[model samples]
Target chain A: MHNRSGLLEACLLILLKENKSYGYNLMNDLHKFGFEEDSLNISVIYRNLRSMEKRGLITSSWAESDQGPRKRVYEITADGEQDLKNWIWMLKNRKSQIETIIEKYENLK
Target chain B: MHNRSGLLEACLLILLKENKSYGYNLMNDLHKFGFEEDSLNISVIYRNLRSMEKRGLITSSWAESDQGPRKRVYEITADGEQDLKNWIWMLKNRKSQIETIIEKYENLK
Candidate 1:
């Protein structure tokens, strides 16, 4: 994704809403959703997760894992759902704008 | 526009392609293209313009104006046109991704 930080956030919200997950699982889900592992920075996702938690969009808690001592589990908050809705609305608006630009480009002579 | 720096660059390129314009006129054109003047930061546009020039996507020159001392005129370079094409391609891809996300959101229950 090219400069898709906001899109990444929206995707994370959607994934968490589907099921509360840990960082590793979320990263895997991101790959499943078209994000290239090589292009994605794990630290960036963690930073975004921390920032979202600070903003009350997500909450993280330590959970005992079968193979590990403990893992941080992330769940979307009500605010995250609302934020996702807002993101969708904004993205829809942007989509139309992009279409307009493309149309204009095609018409250029 | 919410975090639409790339979109802004595309719009600027389109406008410059249409005509080599000065900063003020470009800003006005942007307003006509759905950008709210109040929401836009003039400095950011100038910063982007300077950055584009530095990257050889655009070139600027000082021109004598009818009523002002001199104004900086901006023109899109050949590289800029190619960059515009790339931007359009990327934006098209992003548009489809956005549509997919919107569809997923709508289907969520």
Candidate 2:
């Protein structure tokens, strides 16, 4: 993921890559990734899923979970896999560019 | 910055590095950075500034601009500078970690 906004989505992809999940599971996983508990905005995840679905990257359906209500379960589509692959490629090739920017901003003695 | 959530805030720091700016100006600046006009949420920037101010990373004061209302002109605090420095350092050191993760994600064949 390129930015904080991509965070939830990135996590979503990681989760979907493993298995489809509901909001609570995603939120819990985010906590594992060190996202502040209060800062875990599930709505952002939901919104990103919606956008990704619109882009043919993901698909969702109301599924019954052991927990509360009917949750939206999401799975990665072929396009979603492709998008993730491309993002990873960018991260690989842009490593030097990212390093340069960071070094210019950071002054270590 | 590290993520999209940090985009607005990172842009905020960059802008503050240049000069104090109003909301509209910040929005315009985001457009220059290729943030979709609609995706350029000034509210997130304002919120990050408020949080940064709370953490003593930034300070703001009402400044009379030639525009409509009193705009909050924010400047980076000493702590903010140090935070920026540390973030940059992390960006440098974590480059390999990031690349490794991205590589694990991507399969370019």
Candidate 3:
């Protein structure tokens, strides 16, 4: 199987692609999909969010709050949308490759 | 696209998935596909490798080297092979998602 980083990052992007969210929100949402494990590190989420923001794939704004601290809400940008499109293309391309490998493995088995 | 981490990590896994290779080899090979940029940080490779190994998706061993330190070569484990399957599955599912987003973006454009 592939490493967890891509899946986790892709998932968070997909989530923000749908709507704006905060770091904790992403953590909670992703947790439902088996992202709560050690492989899905909490720091990874923050790191990806910042990295994506720097790439112009996502943009974030701080929401003023009375309690705790200001929450950073991230929204997908236009470039982010296109980026997601490319990611989708990568996924489609990997599909064929995986099929080939699976067939080969089955044959070997 | 969907945050550089996933693409980079996935690309790395896809590399090792082909055959066992060392960190530098994986980094250099991935660099061939636009991974040399800042978004594809070098440390990220080792981090994902460790994470993947921890998940039981990959296995690694130190190979004796003549020129330098022992080079760590990693191979996909049985579970890792299965994990790659799941990763491929995730990619396939994202295809439809990206298509829908593209059509929407085009309509807005």
* Best candidate according to TM-score: 1
User: Model 1, range A1-109, lDDT digits (tens) per residue?
Assistant: 2335378888888889889987777887887556655867788788889989999999999999889678899999999999998888778777788888877778774
Clashing residue pairs in candidate 1 are none
Q: Taking the candidates in order, what DockQ does each have?
A: 0.52, 0.23, 0.09
The 10-residue segment with the lowest total lDDT in model 3 chain A: A100-109
Clashing pairs in model 3, backbone N/Cα/C closer than 3 A: A1-B80, A1-B83, A1-B84, A6-B6
Residues A1-58 of candidate 3: C-alpha lDDT, one tens digit per residue: 3333244555676778667899977888775444325545678689889988998989
Name the candidate, 1 or 2, with the larger lDDT value: 1
Question: What's chain A's TM-score in each predicted model?
Answer: 0.86, 0.75, 0.82
Choose 2 or 3, whichever is better by DockQ. Answer: 2
DockQ of 1: 0.52
Cα distance off (Å), candidate 3, residue A105: 12
On residues B1-109, what C-alpha lDDT tens digit does candidate 1 reach at each position?
A: 2435378888899999889987777888887466655866788789989989999999999999889679999999999999998888877877787777777778774
Question: Which model, 2 or 3, shows the larger TM-score?
Answer: 2
Reference-based lDDT, residue B47, model 3:
88
The lDDT leader among the candidates is 1
Off by over 4 Å in 1: A1-5, B1-5
Question: After superposition on all CA atoms, what RMSD does each candidate show versus the true structure?
Answer: 3.5, 7.0, 8.4
Residue-level lDDT tens digits of model 3 in B1-109: 2333244445556667777887877877765444324545568778888988898878899899989889989987788766666655555444444444344434443
